[model samples]
Target: MSTRVLVQQLQSLPDGPVTVSGWVETVRDQKKVQFVILRDETGAVQLVNPATRPPAEPVDPSTGSRTAEPQDAAADPAERAKRDEALALTDTISTLTTGTFLTVTGQLKHDERVKLGGVEIKVASLDVAAAALPETPIAADSAMDKRMDWRFLDLRQRRNNLIFRVQTTLEHAMRTWWIERDYIEIHSPKLMSSASESNAELFALEYFGEQTAYLAQSPQFFKQMAQSAGFGKIFEIGDVYRADPSFTSRHATEFTSVDAEISWIDSHEDVARMQEELLSFAIGAVAAKHGAEIEELFGVAVSAPTVPFPRIPLAEARDIVAARGYDIPRTDGDLDPEGERQISAHVKETYGHEFVFITDYPHEIRAFYHMRDDETGLTKSYDLLYNGVEITTGAQREHRVDILMEQAKQKGLDPEHLQFYFDFFRYGVPPHGGFGMGLARVLMLMLGESSIREVTYLFRGPTRLAP
Candidate 1:
């Protein structure tokens, strides 16, 4: 009876009898020797078993004639037991499937000929925990939708496993950074009596007695409420819903929004600086922990972006794109997908940086609560783009109740309908500002993944809702 160990730990242990447990990755059933590639959470290893065939006829030395040797039931008990166990293991290893969960008692032997980690396990016994089906529904080359259909099986790939590991480290680092700065962590309600932002993207449902409640599009309103409650700085990493019927690779019906609000920011510049610092910190933490592995697995080097990410006003960015022979197709003066890519290319070429802040968006394209500069009538808002994809939107909020009401009216939003959000301003709130960032979008761009579905644990879109 030996203690179970992970496949990764076997390399460091001295050669002796040991037990390892994991899902079977590959089984090579050869005539003379058998090998199995077993994989666990940490890594994979090779397991070897020499063939133990049944008793056969003995050859005579004189004339090379066969001497009859019938299988005997009454053979020596001890030797028979050993032979039976060996045969059973050989047979069991031959029958094991690719995803079978098993615990193997073996002798860990360091062999130079072994390719996987330069170690091999001579299996003595195997206890099958579960057996997977013979036919696999997906493969490494499976389509994203089909692979997501069987995500539990798909995640068995080492790279997929690493994605989530990196996600965990990134989030923990961000949380630690916030917590150390005395920022309050809050969980705003997902169900709201009114819309959090635009009503067009709201997921409305009947609550009780014909009362309709909507899923929060973002924590924008309540996070601002925290600022008014005297929580100077606050952060929330939680789910936010959007009902947009978009088929783009970057769009999702529900997503994890990493939000932060701070009181007393002079303008959106302060908020942008905080976000840039947060990204650099989180990226550096990931690179320190998993840099080598990420490079090996993802083929992308992880680097902590330098501070003072290149900034260009929205008007200048549009001009830069126009100079490059691309017209923004959108009528609202917002950057289209191609425009973002072109401007990002320009930033990378001119500044040698992967991140850029496109600032000073016109009030026409911004939300009602964003503060507009009096002189230019442009909102103090910015969209953070990384590697040619926009991942965040931040702005200084208009805290004056009078101005807020007027802005809501100008945007054709009824003041009475938004009275709850307006109430926060009336109670004398701070000059607060914050941003909402898409976590998957950041990971996708960082990892050089082509689609947000690649980084999201469970993608929610217009068509995808099940596991």
Candidate 2:
């Protein structure tokens, strides 16, 4: 009846009686000894038991007597009782299956020779809680889709577990940094009367059996409303929906968006400065806490990004990509995927940085709410790229009601339909800007993973919608 201890705790405790509970990972039943590798959430440990085999005898059918020597009667009562207990324990261990949840009472011994955690446990008794089927559906080399089909089982791998741990540490660090700086956290409603960003990517559903409500593509409108409501700064980590049918490595139907908006910014540069600093703080915290484990598991060294990430205008970035012998194939005036990768390579080679801000996008490719420079006719916006992928979009918003209406009109959006959003500007809001970033994208890049699906807890893509 010893207190149950985690496998991780065995290393710090002195050799003594202890109880450990976890699912069975592996078992090695040898002729003279038995070994069980039990893994709990914290870690795995080795459990040892001396083998006790049953006596081989031919019973006399009528007399209930054995031809072999009757060791049970000849031995002392205490010795017989101990032998019986050992035989039972050995049988129980033999019947144990992989992934069976069990509790074991044992003597914890620290042995230098023990490969796992330099500790071993001499199991005295085991109590099986739940037994698993012998066959497991997934393996280490299973295809990604097959593994995702059994995500619960897939997550049992230690490397997968560390991804979430790193995510938790990253999120907590970001939240702490924001709260310390007096940023208000908000949860904007997901069901909106209209699209939050663009009409093309909205999930409209029937609401109250009367009107239609659209799933928000972003918290853009409400975050802007907060600026008008006099909230100087706000941050939100919440789910956003997109109706995009993209089958790319980074696209998802639903995702967690990490958003931040601050009032009284001079231009998009202010927002970029804040975001870079925020990322630096969060990454530094993660590196300090889990750097060694990340390198061990993911083989990627986690480092805090330097301040003042190199900035290149969108036009200049395209030129840099072209100069590298690649022409952007798209005519949208925005950097295509290849263009982003090329520009990222150039920045890495020239500045030795993994991040760059591509600023001053042409107004054609930006949202209507983004402020445009009167002289340049380009939006005061920037796309933040990390590890050659665009992870965020931030911009100075058009706070003037007149300009907002004209911009909306130019984009073929009815000003009356968006009057509710325009009302925020009518009340005299301060000049503000912010960014929305994909949480999974950031984690994937941090871990050097190829797809965001590797980092997402439950990725919702076009074709995936189940356990």
Candidate 3:
């Protein structure tokens, strides 16, 4: 009745009996011996078993010649039981398939030659918990869509497991940093009577009666409401839905949004400084905890970014890109994918940093609630870019009730329909700002993954809905 131990714990224990449970990763049923590569949540280990063959034909002692059949009538009872058990164990190992869940009781041994954590287990018995099918649905060389189809099985890969572990560390570190600074955590309602941002990219559905409800695009309005409610600072990690149909690598129908709102900010610069410091601290925690494994699995070195990440205004960033021989094709006063890449490359070359904040976007391309500078007329907002991709957008919001209503009207949104939102500002709220960041996008960039799908646990794209 040995308790189950994780593969990672084996390295620290002295050689003795131990039980390990995990799904079978690989099995090699050799003629003389069997080898199984068992993987648990923590790590993978080697399981060894000596193959027990059937007894040889009975030799006739009188003539010293082999007989046609073996006799069991005179066999020792105890010896017969041991031989039968051994044969059965060997057969079970031979039939074991990949991805089968099982528990093994064995003698844990440390061996310098063993590659997997320099440890091996001599299995005495195996208890099958669940047997997997003989054939696998996906392969190592499978396409991204195919792999995503069987995501549960696909996540069995060691690299995929580490991706989530890194994510956990990153989030915990960020939460710790916020909580230490007296930040409140909030969970905003997902079903809202009105859109959080705009009419576009909203998933609307029928409510209890004739009224309709929409899935929140972000926790923008609620986060602001908290600010009005006298919550000085708050953070939320929750799911937000978008009706965007784009099949881009970064777009998702539903995603976890990491949001933070703080009251009494002078401008977007305050928000930017806070976000940069938050990222630097979180990334440093990840580098400290799982840096080696990340580098080994993802082939990307994880490092904490320095504070005061390079900042370039939207117009200046475009000019920098143009200087590098790339023109932003979009006419919306926002950087296209190519423009972002070019600007990011410039930042990396000039400042030696992977993160850059493209700030002071034209009001035409920004949300109406974003505060407008009296001097420049541009919105005091910024898009945080990491490794050539935009991961977050933050801004100083207009808290004045009159100004807020006017801005809403300018964007073609009816003030009557947004009265509930405006009520927060009418009650005398402080000037506030915050940011909503895509969690998957941050993880994807950190791990050097090409798509957010690799980091998202269950990605919801326009065309993908099932498990």
Provide the RMSD of all predictions against the true structure, rounded to 1 decimal: 2.5, 2.5, 2.2
Find the candidate with the highest lDDT and give its number: 3
TM-score of each: 0.96, 0.96, 0.97
The TM-score of candidate 3 is: 0.97
Kindly indicate the candidate among 2 and 3 with the higher TM-score: 3
- Error in Å for residue 192 of model 3: 0.3
Candidate 1 residues lying further than 4 Å off, grouped into runs, are: 56-69, 72-74
Where does the lowest 10-residue lDDT sum fall in candidate 2? 66-75
C-alpha lDDT of all candidate models, in order = 0.93, 0.93, 0.94
Q: Which segments of model 2 are wrong by more than 4 Å?
A: 58-70
Question: In candidate 1, what are the lDDT values of residues 50-161, reduced to their tens digit?
Answer: 9887767778999899877776654899989888888898989989999999998888999888888999888888899999898899999999999999989989999989
Report the C-alpha displacement of residue 127, candidate 2, in angstroms.
Answer: 1.5
**How do the residues 250-322 of candidate 3 rate in per-residue lDDT, one tens digit apiece?**
9999999999999999999999999999999999999999999989988999899998999999989988899
Give the clashing residue pairs of candidate 2, or none: none
Clashing pairs counted in every model? 0, 0, 0
